[model samples]
Target: MSEHVDVLIVGAGLSGIGAACQLRAGHPGRSVAVLEARDVSGGTWDLFRYPGVRSDSDMFTFGYRWRPWPSETALADGPLILDYLRTVAEERGVDRLIRYRHRVVSAAWDSATARWSVVVDHDGVESTITCDLLWGCTGYYDYERGHRPEFPGEESFAGQVVHPQFWPEDLDHTGLDVVVIGSGATAVTLVPALAEKARHVTMLQRTPTYIIPQPDRDPLAVALRRLPERVRYPVVRWANVLKLVANYQLAQRFPAQARKLVRRLAEKSLPSDTSYDEHFQPPYDPWDQRLCVVPDGDLFRALREGGASVVTDSIETFTPGGIRTTSGRELAADLVITATGLELKLFGGIEITVDGEPLVASETMAYKGLMLSGVPNFVFTIGYTNASWTLKADLVGDYVVRLLDFMDARGLRTVVPVREDAVGERPFMDLQSGYIQRAVAWLPRQGDRAPWQLKQNYFVDVRTIRRGEIDDDVLAFT
Candidate 1:
């Protein structure tokens, strides 16, 4: 027999748990169930087990608004993040509503019944669950596989190759020479962490990425912790938000000045002998791609202490023991760690069909960065690329609950964003990163105007999503 529910939440991660908590608080009568593909609840936090895996953004904004993050540390590690997520789930009884290993394969919407028939794969068994509303909290990355670029002569490499996404537990790197391929957040993080255990660590990148050094513990948060969480949470959260906004604006408005400022800051953390322009300076301006944050200047410290090194070059081929660069330089390594990047996938690779017709994500336009145009009774959580993901995730959860409440008061069964005209379409994410650019063809498009265009700013999103009118003309109700 098919199970029935008022709402079926896909992916029991940070967003899913937040959504469930919001639903419980706002609409207590609604029957909600969360379907998790993985055995564990913490999605990204649980999936990535690599050394020095931590939040790129500060925990103050990264954490949910409703639940105050207890840690004084602005940046937290994977285990701590996982613990926080699990605590929220177990404490709120959201764990009871989740079905582990229940991977959603397809969702078919029936206009006649105004419900979604979701087909889920539970281990090897397949089952169906019908729901009035389907909320997709599955993040925009392929958890099954990280992006591994095919290097020439990779088959000839004798050493064990590893990806940060699927880090092996028993793969010992003690006193071994490690070469991490990528200059993004993961590469920067792993370099310092691995430098402690490995004999030497090298961060190999084709081009440089903007790196910023930040204090692991926020001084403001440290002082605020003396007070109660009720008094401290909002104060710290807003202060961090304001700081983020000011920094973002400075980067956007004055690119050259911002770039110089960031480079200067990074130079201070690096060795006095090392040239910042050669190793630390990126080709693009600030915020062109996401900046890598090094907590307490860990990466720079590793470099200064001669534990790690950075090489900016293109890989010609993977040699038997290491990599040969285009610049005729060969780097020897015992282990080649591909910190390359993630493969972006939407809705956990679930196929969506409405009235027996398949829906293409790229063809559809995103409505307010949450719902897709022409998609009914469905909402997906997508956070800001430039800011803390959970900040937008919390807002999305609140907005969704508000939308549901609006529907309940009006006796509406279906809600979908209807396109009024042929709006000019642009890429969903305005990032210049390799992973985002490569996946643009498969991702959704954004319109040239409001309601269809995504406001990447959290401050703007808060006002628009939380305080803006829900009964807009663009959204059709039935």
Candidate 2:
């Protein structure tokens, strides 16, 4: 491979791969290289292997733009998603540009040279590469660590403890009493799958999360069958956006009303004996924390079917046989699956420096949720907070190509967000999700208006990013 390239993408995941495809399709002869941290591609899909793992969103829009999901169902399992990503990478010829097992350690921008010097560790040896543009598609997934809570006597407990993030391939669960801790998407997915195979599955959650039940068969299945790829894809995509927007608007304007409607929906799918207010009702407002969607209430069905059960209590400590609850109950478990949420890391834990000045994530302002203040010739893709991740990511990819195309036409080599002293009134993350709240200290903060604000709304993003002027006053060009 060449030592230098026009663009150096720092991930091989969905967004990164999508960016590569966009760049290739727009500018066919441009030299681009994708540096992946792991040995294989498929970022989230490759990392997660827990049972019942699938896209919470419909796969119709979740799959790549160039590729159509072959599954009859719109929501697919992990392996199928990985295969789709691999297919897209191969078909688009982006796989050849990826250098696996190369983790970017640090990137420094040189003002004089108008290039970025990126240091990466391949296998064990470290090397430096220079590029005109540094595009970070390293997604928000916690690659560095998993967020597992510390229980008293955790080390002393004799039971095997495993996290779903790093599930062992050869591990056996037959006849084992499995205790899953947490109530997020991961926990919900794991509990139902393990309950079927294990002796018993217990879900211990401290707080209840709003759960919405979806149909077993994907809603998009009919569309895929009746509509052509050209019509089906856009229809599904817009439908997803409309649904997401309606949900968001409901959550924002009338949270209580929305919650009641959602609770009623859940109750309709659940057993008659199920208590919606106690088991399903969330403390926070709807969309304050993300409402997890269950595929046909499988998790609820698993609980109702008797192999699985829910324990709405805090874990006091780890006992010899299982977990000891704060309510003075001891749950027996041969295996413990910590389905706790992921640990968030910024820029894939890589240090960013601007002209030898160390750049902290919190100090940098986001420009169109892509470029950072005081960072030049760099573009990163951060998707929607409430909807399908790919909706915004795909738009960002198209925007990046457009921006680059504009630069080419104008004979511009450098693009950077000009820093200012003004502060913003709005919070960086307006939502109250645990993942966002927990990582607020480590996350990037936004400012008042353009270049610093992050609009989670898809329509605003599409207009500002896709059709807006790339060479604006806020973004300095040379």
Candidate 3:
């Protein structure tokens, strides 16, 4: 049997749930169905179960605008966040609209009918859903698995191997010496948390990241749980935004000051004799790549308390017993946790096509970081790579709802992009950051224009997305 809906949402993550909530509220008579690939709907939060799994950004701006978080802590762990998402879905009636364990395998658009034919796998059976509009919120994280570095003789090493995404539920680390690979956020987070249970936790990193330790608490959030939303929401949100902007400004305009402070912290955190010049300093400027934040000097405190530590050396290979470092040290480990970072998957592995022809992501330009050129009725919410992801995500959501309302009022059934000849010919992707550069080949590019280019500035995004006219000729109305 087949089902039909006014709108079909893929992946019931933050974006999907947010889209559903707004769609239902705006058009009360419309039927919207969200299909989640996994049985659970927390997306990234539900998938990553490593110890001390938390957000780098404060939950104040990271949380939904409609429902403010009561926690004072800026850094929220996985369980709390997962619980928050579940609560939002349930409270907003989004849970009822979700079809759990339904994975969308393929979606083919019929240009003649102007509707999407979506194929989903449900409980070992394939079913189809037809919808006038399709919303994708699959998120950037690949659910298939995370990126694991291939170590020489890793399979032969007898130690239990684990990744943060697929952490063993029953694996007991008590009294075991553990070695975690990589120096990204995941690696830094695991060191502090695992040190509590493991005999020793060694973090191996080839290059050091710009690390800044900050107070993870939010004072406004602490005072707001007792107050009503009308009185508290704006104050807290604005305050967080101010701080993010100020810090970002410092990193952008006065890079030296930020670098000096980071250097000072590293010097104070590490041993006096330890080479602050060598092990602590990064090759690039601060914030050139993503700067990792540690709470309460957790990693430093763990190192002090446990006497277990950080080693800056490339992994030479895996020995029969453990890992062999480039420093010619063989580190013995009872368990190995590969905290090596994630692999980027564009649009959650969905193959996008327009008007019965395939759409090449690299060929298209990014439209205000939310929409892409040549893609119609599609608004993707990707937040600032440097700042809090949710701050921009919230704005993007508001803009999308407003755009939809504008279309419906005018009795428009379709919205398609008008490809400007000049914008399409320009080179789109150019960022020096390793993460962005690594996946540049796969990511959708952008051109130099009002709607085609991506401006990282929040103020610019606000002017463009929120206040912009909906009836512009570039965005064709049908």
**lDDT by residue (tens digit), candidate 3, 322-441:** 899988998989899888777777777876667778878887777667777766666676777767776677677777677778878888877766668886434343435544666778
Best-to-worst order by lDDT is 1, 2, 3
- Compose the digit string of candidate 2's lDDT tens values, residues 335-448: 999888887777788898999999887777777788788889888887777878887788888888898898899999998888778766355677676777788875777878
Candidate 1 runs further than 4 Å off: none
- Supply the global lDDT for candidate 3: 0.78
Stretches of candidate 2 off by over 4 Å are: none
lDDT of 1 by residue, 178-247 (tens): 9999999999999999999999999998889999999999889888778988999899999999988889
Each model's C-alpha lDDT?
0.91, 0.83, 0.78
Per-candidate TM-score against the hidden true structure: 0.99, 0.96, 0.94
Residue pairs in collision within model 3: 58-74
Per the 3 Å backbone cut-off, how many clashing residue pairs does candidate 3 have? 1
